[model samples]
Target: MSYVALYRTYRPKYFKDVFGQKVIVQTLQNALLHEKFAHAYIFSGPRGTGKTSIAKIVAKALNCEKAPTAEPCGECAVCLGIDKSSVSDVIEIDAASNNGVDEIRDLRDKVKYAPSVGKYKVYIIDEVHMLTQAAFNALLKTLEEPPKYVVFILATTEVHKVPATILSRCQRFDFKNIDTADIEANIKKIVNKERLKISNEAINAIAITSEGGMRDALSLLDQVVSFTKDEISEEDVYKVSGGLSRRFISELLQTIYQKQPQKALDFLNQVLQDGKDISRMVSDIILALRDVLLDKIREDKKYPELNGLTPPLIYAYLDILNELQQSLKYTTSKRAYLELAIIKMMNHQSIEYVELNQKIDALQKEMHNLETRLRSEVQVKQVESSKNIKVQSKSNLKPLVTVSEISEILNQGDREKKNLLKIGWPSLADYEVPQLRGVAKLLHEGSLEAVGANRMLLVYDDIITAQNMLKKETKEKVLKIINSKKQLIDDYTVLLKADWMILKDDYAYQYNAGISKPKLKEIDLHLYEQDEDSIQEVKLEEDPLVEFAKASFGENLVKVEE
Candidate 1:
């Protein structure tokens, strides 16, 4: 006799032989043990997950010589006949080929007959979702009210296609993908029984590649056994399965993370040169990233290449690879797309670097502006003192909020209210009031630092921008827009990013040291409002070109050559 395939040779003949579906097996056993099994059952799940195999086992359990038993006695004539497909009473139908109203009608006509040999007659339909609407309709009434001695079991990988009308009439059992460990153990048992020369690594490789499918694992193992002459190795599994080794994947990820584009390109070229599937390589990278993400969440250090990487960065990597996977399907130049994806990931690191440089430049400019303004004010003070005239210099301008007010706001900060403002802040750019929309747009230059019961803090990298946002007209317009949407905030203030950082650090230090916060009096809103007359007076007095020259050339480099 010709050698049978491993999957078929090791097909489960009894309930005890099935693996990785303990709950389903136990439920079926209890139902059978009490002789309360349903007349019609629907089994659904992914391929090779035992949906059809379990259906067969159920058929044997119902028709075995020892009827109503949880485990079928494969030695009995009825069980043997059912297993061999020789029993007239146990009918296995491939709905994919035989799905039709006439075939179903014929089945309906035959449901009235008594069992030919066993105590019960069972109909097992595989891929029942393939049945046409008319066919399903034909089987509906018979399925709903089958004879006592007759049982119907339908199996499909896609249960969503199964009509609700058909689903409502039968007991549904969803088979899950078998766990990898269980699949590995089962493979080991088979190897030991067959005395196959295979390494543990090879077994593990097969188990992972199968992706929770027992039939797939066994089939892959069979292919490897046939391809190898001696003891099977992990490399042999990878070669046969067209999958990359975990080490190669790790190395590739390290190159990508370390921003070594040449090495990444070399890895892709090697994969292409060796006739490996580019799409599969992308998929494997995604799976590796997924593993790294899990390790990150669990606070484990399994993937060292991803040690310092944050979850968002890993997600971005996965997103790039995922897009590559999708693009590979449409383009014939798979290598080009894969190469582009590698470059994209390597370049991802530049985004944060660019933003950091921008913030640094903004802070430097703001510092220079403040320095020039302070020097101008000092010169003006000297001029005024020489003339013996009282004048209010810009240097005398008060901050939008005092330290006490900021402290109070910090003490009264509400996390929930802050989150609400942060979430809604993005919408301010499109405020309904067209006149105030520009003012609202200016707020986006900064960030919502903290929100309190009645006060909100905005922080900007540029001091000038922060000061502009604090002006009475801009502040009023922004407040109007914000209050029109959400009436949570009654007042708001702006601070330089540097100042906000200092305040945040201080707040954290004080709170951690268990210092009791003192309640300060409510801030006077009028103090934050700039007087238009005072601003016009200062602008008229200060020389615009002198200010610009001071900002452009350093204060030390510029001279008053009047």
Candidate 2:
């Protein structure tokens, strides 16, 4: 004789009583009518979407005294017993608490017995995703091949957690969120049937808050109904649910649209002072802005307050409010964030100002690109002119010291051995110690090819990596690390590995073996003797005529007897 909750009191006993799941209901009934019912069923979907409810309904339909009928006779003892949870054959287990291997083994043992009362025994396990791996594994064999008269129904909010093996053996049904219109219609029916006086606005508010869950809609309606004896207004729903009213949302948006920043802030402060939730206020504002956007798109003047505002401006308002809604989760000063969000929304520049700024930015970027192109063209012209002049002046200019002369000087003087430059060549690559290993990796492509007191030549396989070393910061770091213990060298000349190879071959051929063989200096030839495999062979067939002309013209053209 106690009052029953609305959700339980009005629970769907027949398939026709359920809403928003016509496909599932039709499919289950067709399977039942043809005697093609699956032995194992898995119901998976979001919480409170009638997954468990549908499973129970299927149980009632299967074991009805009418025998394999799609509709259960609620008057029968078997149907009543299942509805009241008193049936021995129709068992409902909460998997959250009983999810263990031992519990599953006990279940497997009990599944073999025939139904004591009904023709079929049904087991409904809720939250089956909570079952441990061992429990699932133990239940797999029995689920795949249960007794002929036994049926297993598994329900879970997360289907991904269930093993594929169990899923393969069961017929899966996906429950969808109840549509808002469906929820609204269903609530209206309950209101009418209960003979309660509730406004349309209050019913809409409950539907929106339910978020596609029918049970939630009923519970919220029940809560609102309990507090009021007379007609339930929108204010009662907002007050009970800690939500904001449309008037508050409308006034706040009006101040923002009119660009009255201080007035907007004051209004928000007043809402907080009256105990309105910050998050709820933001959500309500978002919904109002969405309606404004819809009206803007439709070109309908449903909301007179949004008549003057453009679509972009309304969208900007929505973006700010939504962003603040997210940022409030991490902050303690919700009121402060909300106020700042309103001021930002109000202070946003008019459409004309925003477009003008965008135009200016685009023009500046174009001008910068033009300047860069002109500067690069000027540098290219300068380089070409310099190269032409060098070609014309090559007959007049002569090296102050030739390679032969340098070789003599290097071989004759004991300074070649005593110079710290020679000793530093071997350790330069290794100098990129662990601390500077990143720079060292870049340097490894090149080695210390030639060393002198004033300068040294380093070769790198990749030109880009070599150029990276030529950067001012990179040059400083390399020199600092190299001379950290002792400053043996002052400056460096970074060269491509190919260029270094050419220079070495030319020096060796002119002074040691190829074109002009000069008298040998007892230099430490060991320092320059390259591995035969490392030396690249040059064939006359591969040379272009210009290179042949240079080689034939002698190292210098017009050899004059002075």
Candidate 3:
């Protein structure tokens, strides 16, 4: 009299009718035929993989009046009763709601009674992982040593949460996620049987979005069918599901790759305006990038847009987008954050080089903290000592900048001498490659000093920037880009501005060169917390004891220990 959902209407009544999980079905069928079925069985896998449906089919087959048959006789009273969920002997328990020691104890009491009409009294407990420890302990004995007429079937999406004692007592069968092709085929069979007119694209879209879940796919189809009177299309599926189109994603990425920040931002606004979730939009972007990466690696020519994109850049896109997606949950203004992240990603020189910048920033912060700690320790010692006592001056101590001695090359033959001689510094900013362009811009912050046969040295205004130049990815990208222009050097190193002043003095003293000794100031170190906008304050529940102490002690005397 009432319309049933597609998933429920098409629920498998027999093993042959179940889509996907062929191996599991065959195993159960053979076990039933050979009379080798286990007293207790465990079916575990991802949701919508037909764990419960398979359990019901097995129950019907075992309890059929036909007796020990591989296939149940649907006309028989026992089979009909099980199918209608009216059978007294075949019980289906929702462990998610009924999981308790008392409930399990009640089940144990009922298990001793013989079947009313069939050979076996079946107990199918779904979501068995929800059972508490005590409930599991109660079920363990029954599962391990049940009556001859009893069979226990436990199903869970998460098998790990099931107790080991309960697991050890059952014969386990792991259900795999249904393949997309199998899901598509299953949908097609449903469409034809139901006389529903659906486009191939709609079917494919449903299959892809279901993500290997048959019930989910059917549910989506049912929703689409209810929305559209006839002739379902891909657009209808996307509209109903709030999914993005590949064309729009491809266009957005193209705009970003071309460094059109405003255009990309506008497009992002359009997507959000259309009621798409910001987090879901980021996920779609990441998925598109993943497809491009796979296409590039496999050289499949599936995504022509990814033809020239480098793997490092693709990886960088994934990393930044993933971080953006994670940060969205903490903010109320999702649109603003999404816009800023998109603009940064588009304008950033190389996705890979961002890693180097983050590393440098972290290291610089750590170095400053270390310096502050040392300074505080020195000040404390000075205070402890007599006020008239003189402390040693750190001003005269030279900055710690070390380099390999060059005497060996200087004393070598003409070839070595020529190889070690300085050459004119080339500008890296003019490189064409995006990866190269980014590295070159960062490298431009320092002054190039000398170029040897295989190595070069440069000086930077700060120690941290110089250290960043030495990062493996940054260094490799710099060398690759520079070498592409001219094979001048293969490796390079950096020196701080203060240290460069000392090096200039050495060169002037040793070679009688016109280089002058430049005076340098020690860097000022100050500590500050990271940007307030980026820091998310998490609400942690207070411990009951701490709360009680604070309430009783007027909050002032309460000291919370870490």
C-alpha RMSD values across all candidates: 8.9, 20.1, 23.8
Per-prediction TM-score, please? 0.64, 0.60, 0.61
Q: Rank the candidates by lDDT, best first.
A: 1, 3, 2
Supply the TM-score for candidate 3.
Answer: 0.61
Q: What lDDT would each prediction earn against the true structure? A: 0.81, 0.74, 0.75
Which regions of candidate 3 are displaced past 4 Å? Answer: 297-302, 305-308, 352-562
What are the per-residue Cα lDDT tens digits for candidate 2 across 1-562?
9988888888899998898889989999999888899999999988778888888888888889996888888889999999998889988889999999999999999999999888889999999999999999999999999999999999999999999999999999999989889888988999889999999989988888887888988998899999898899888888788787777777877887677888888887776777888898888888777787777667654466766666667767777877898999999999889888877876656534654666788899998886555433433332223322122232333322234533333233334433555455456556546777666556555676555545556665543465567676777777776677776556565654444444566566665654453443322111121234443443323213233335556646633343
Which of the numbered candidates is closest to the native, going by highest TM-score? 1
Local accuracy of candidate 3 as per-residue lDDT tens digits, 277-353: 87877877887788888886575554697566667667777777878888898999888888887777766666638
lDDT of model number 3: 0.75
Estimate the overall C-alpha local distance difference test score of candidate 1.
0.81
> Alpha carbon lDDT of residue 557, candidate 1?
89
Model 2 has a clash total of: 1
